[model samples]
Structures are given as C-alpha cells and as structure tokens.
Target: MAASACATGLRGSLVSSFHGTWGTSMMGEDYPALIQSVPRYVRVGPPVRSPPCMKNVNEGKGIFAPAVVVTRNIIGKKRFNQLRGKAIALHSQVITEFCKAIGADGKQRQGLIRLAKKNGERLGFLA
Candidate 1:
C-alpha cells in the first residue's frame, strides 16, 4: 500500500487519501477571509403561529402577557471571541434604532424591547 497510489487517485485507496495524514495538515490553517468568503449566516424565521398559548409573567405587581424572543447564532469559538465587539455594536445600533423610532428617553432598556402600548384597553400596538 504505497502512499503514491493514493496521491495519484488511481485506486482510490485510503493510504494515499487526504483524510488522515500529516502530509497536508497545514491545509487546515484557517484563513479568516477564506472562511468569511463562505456563506455562514443562515436565518430561518419563526414558524407559522399555531394559536400561541397565553403565558403569564409578573411585572410591577401584576400578571402581564409574556412575549418570548429566542435567537440562535452559529459562531465558532475563535470567531465568537473575535466578533464580540461587532456583536455589541450591532446590538447598540438596534437599540438606537428602537429608541429613535419609539421616541424613548433611552433610560429603561427593558421598556425598549417590549414596545407594546395600549390605547383605552382596546386596541394596542406592538413593534
């Protein structure tokens, strides 16, 4: 089982394959641009609403409707550490946009996420 047979791809044997050999381990060296060139971020929106159940949460001494927000990000360990600042900056931008749209005083962060306001306990706005 000479390694040359695998290199030439004539017999398609494991002896000459790239799967497990120190011959080309440097090929594993990750280049940021090369990795970034690959499309990574895949966004899948929430499923169709199936008559959402009413969940109660306590707020200000009263039970209020709860809105759930869940996000999943696929970032490798090194990339996670590297993108911390970028992630925070994007979050800050979103916060700024929300504040500008709602005309909030930018004091209460909790108040910003849930921007639902009631008008005479009948119709409401959630944005």
Candidate 2:
C-alpha cells in the first residue's frame, strides 16, 4: 500500500512539473490558443519581378547588333551612336575600295555582305 501511494505521488508531481514548464493543461487543449497569440509577419510592398535596367540587346537590326548593344552599354548612348555611324561609313568605304581593287560588282559585294550576315546569325549574334 505504501509503494502504491508513493508511485501515485511521483506521477502527480511529474504532471504538475510538465504543466508548469509548458504553460499548458495536461490534455493540451490550450495549444491552439497559444499558437494564435504569436505575432504574424506581413510584406510591406509588391514582390520584385525583374531588374530596372534590362536593355533589350535585340533592338539593333544588323550582323554586329550584339557588339553594338554591348558597346552602347559600356559607352554612353550618344557617344556610341556617333562612333557607330562613323564605323559604318568607314566600313562601307573600305568595302567599296576593296571591290574596286578586285573588279567585283555591286551584286558581288551585296552577296558577300549577305553571307557575312548569315554567318553572324548562325554564330548566335542575333540571339
């Protein structure tokens, strides 16, 4: 009888200690209320979709479009445009002189330009 009473007392102390540490009843019916008392987090603004300055590299429509876009980004837009125009004019002049030296006609020069454009596209410059 004494051993049985001691066992009951030990079980009661364990239950009381558990209730004190957890701040809950023996059946845990207050768990939902405890969880509801916790603070919730909320976002302040809309989520980010993309970067602010995502320039489209496909805006330029030529065999050297990608190079032009990269150079434009490195240099200012105004300076890049000026340099691009001068380079294009120089390229045309050089091509015209080479065609004259080789006795090639306008049609042959145009075909060569088309071939270079095709090769550039295949190499993913148009991408």
Using lDDT, give the best candidate's number. 2
In the range 21-42, model 1's lDDT, one tens digit per residue, is 5645654656555767877665
Stretches of model 2 off by over 4 angstroms after superposition: 1-70, 117-127
Candidate 2 per-residue lDDT over residues 61-110, each given as its tens digit: 65666775687788988897687567656766777788899999999988
RMSD of each: 22.3, 15.4
TM-score each candidate. Answer: 0.25, 0.38
Error of 2 at 57 (Å): 8.3
User: What CA RMSD would candidate 1 show?
Assistant: 22.3
Relative to the unseen true structure, what is the C-alpha lDDT of residue 115 in candidate 1, on a scale of 0 to 100? Answer: 40
